[model samples]
Target: MPPFDQTRFRLPRGARADAVLAGGVFVVVALGAEGQRLSHGEDSAPSQIASWLLIAAVCGTLLFRRRYPVTAGWFTVLGTGAYYLLSDIDGPLVIVPIVALYALAAQGRMQAAIGMAAAMIIGMAAITLAGSSDVTGTAVFMLTGWLVAVVALGSARHSRLAYAEEEARLRATEERLRIARELHDVIGHNISMINVQAGAALFRLKKDPAQAEEALGAIKASSKETLRELRATLGVLRRVDEQAPTAPAPGLARAAELVASAQLAGLPVRIERTGPERSLSAPVDLAAYRIVQESLTNAAKHSGAGQVTIRLAYGDRELALDIEDDGQGSAARPAGSGGGSGITGMTERARALGGELTAGPRPEGGFAVRARLPYGTTGKPMERSDR
Candidate 1:
């Protein structure tokens, strides 16, 4: 048989849970009180007259334990002690205190639980050792064991809840960081091109109307691309049931458009491919595209590179991406000092997919970004089927 799926018990939480638990305990104790009444002779009606009422009081107070664990625990424990002092019966009613102790411990009230446990241990010892008492050492041992088990269960429950909450928080943090990187790459690249084109349009507005018109066209194209990419990047935040925007994510297949936009931004970029071009997974393709985009943008903005080159090489076991700029390189903008979110974002993208990216000044000149993404586990990329 298949293992049972335990996720079914991850029930919605609220006060109703407390009511259900308290009601179940109430039924068990009510039955026990009935049995106690039956055991008594006709002459002892006084002791058994209101016993069920007392059990009701104990279980009813426990309903509030989830919201006020410490307070409810004390009320129930004191009620049990009172019952023990007045009643001639034992055993069946002991579950009342055990349940309360478990609640207190599970709620993370260690001090209150410890106090109640000590009180019960002392009370049991006193009552058992008193005149003509027949309770044996094994009974005491069993009671002690039950108390320890109650505390252990509660502590384990508290620890699991805390750990699950922390795990959720960490997942949220990682998701936000990933979104931040996407936003940085999209906005930073497009806005840089837009800014450059706007400047060109302003410079040529009176001197050369044709050049000014062309610059404005580039600005329009870049603006549209920016909005589309922005929507795609932010669409992950939408509800799962909601329909996402139709804009597709940027990938290596559209890399030429990125190079064209860079050229219009006053930096000439040449893109090349080696080995047979094959289809890559969407995530790897997006990462590779963004890496090239950021490198080209950085070259235009900081390095003042007149010419940049992007190379995509497909291997039997891995895909390699190289970006090199022929600008002043480290001389114009020193390595690591050109500091911004660009390189860091690129590095994050690479590492997220178990790849490594290295970027620094070349031995001869210019800066180079080289990334190696292994694909053996995923197998060699298959050739894209043409329409």
Candidate 2:
């Protein structure tokens, strides 16, 4: 058994075509019926039979109007016109063409459909006027009804197409955002650590060979971590049908791993939890993890910083992450510094999810990164006076 698709509700094109073809046949029969009745000039059996056959053929074509709407409309119009001109049938013969015209307006090209409708109205008026009968009521009813049907159905089709296109665009946008978030979580974290350790290694290479080697080892480790993460994220971007080795990317639960890695790279990382220890929403947790990772990276880059403390606090409505490093605080740094691309990217990530991020040096001495996210309306605050 195949999975049911809720979206597949449209009438098949072929089915509509068949219906239109049937309608064209009916138009011819209907005209013949009116001709026979007029020839007899009385309520005769032969005339009645001809009219019934014609009505059946024209009505049958109604089923296929959607599939070959234009063709059916044109045929009905021609057949109806011929019937009226040859048979002297009254207003009822006009109904077939009016119906076909409406179908055309609903599904055919707008300019052409409108033109056909105009022609039908004009032809009907000429016939009625030439016959010198009071046809204003019938003409108005037929033309108005056809125009309304066309406008309504055409507008519906246009709206449906627009909605489908919008949905497709939104899905694409979401996929891109998801990929970007994953990349920031993976490569951004590793690059920060690697850049810091490499800078430290270069500084120590000539002065202290042993320290240089240690820093170099840290750089290698960070590079490997970055590469692993990059590979995993890219794999997620691959098509499902494409064969590739897949690895899961780290989420918030891997904060301990990130902290351990930072510690190994000569940065002392202290992880503190102030909120009731509980699992967080995936997005919130991912955001919290990235904030800490970025702060640790900044610590390694700016100065020979040690003792970095990361605190996670959860309140009833919001989740807060704070990263503090004992590096040169805001006072130690020059003004107009540190608002680089990395900070800009981090800010974008937080704001995209309706979160807020603030970064500055602590007054006491060191840099601080803080992010607040509204995860859900539940959770106890982790009580911490000094983190």
**In order, what lDDT does every prediction score?**
0.80, 0.67
Q: Write the per-residue lDDT of candidate 2 for residues 276-371, one digit (tens) a residue.
A: 665566666666677676667667667457688888876667778888888877554443334444565567668866889988877887888888
What stretches of model 2 exceed 4 Å from their correct place? Answer: 1-136, 205-213, 241-249, 266-268, 302-307, 325-353, 360-367, 377-387
Q: What range of 10 consecutive residues in model 2 has the weakest lDDT sum? A: 378-387
Among all candidates shown, the one with the greatest TM-score: 1
Model 1 residue 208 lDDT?
90
**Residues 229-343, model 1: lDDT tens digits:** 7766655577455466665568887888888888777788888788877767878888998999888878877787878989989888778999998777667665454355778
Task: Evaluate model 2: give its lDDT.
Answer: 0.67
Off by over 4 Å in 1: 1-13, 40-46, 49-53, 131-134, 240-248, 330-339, 384-387
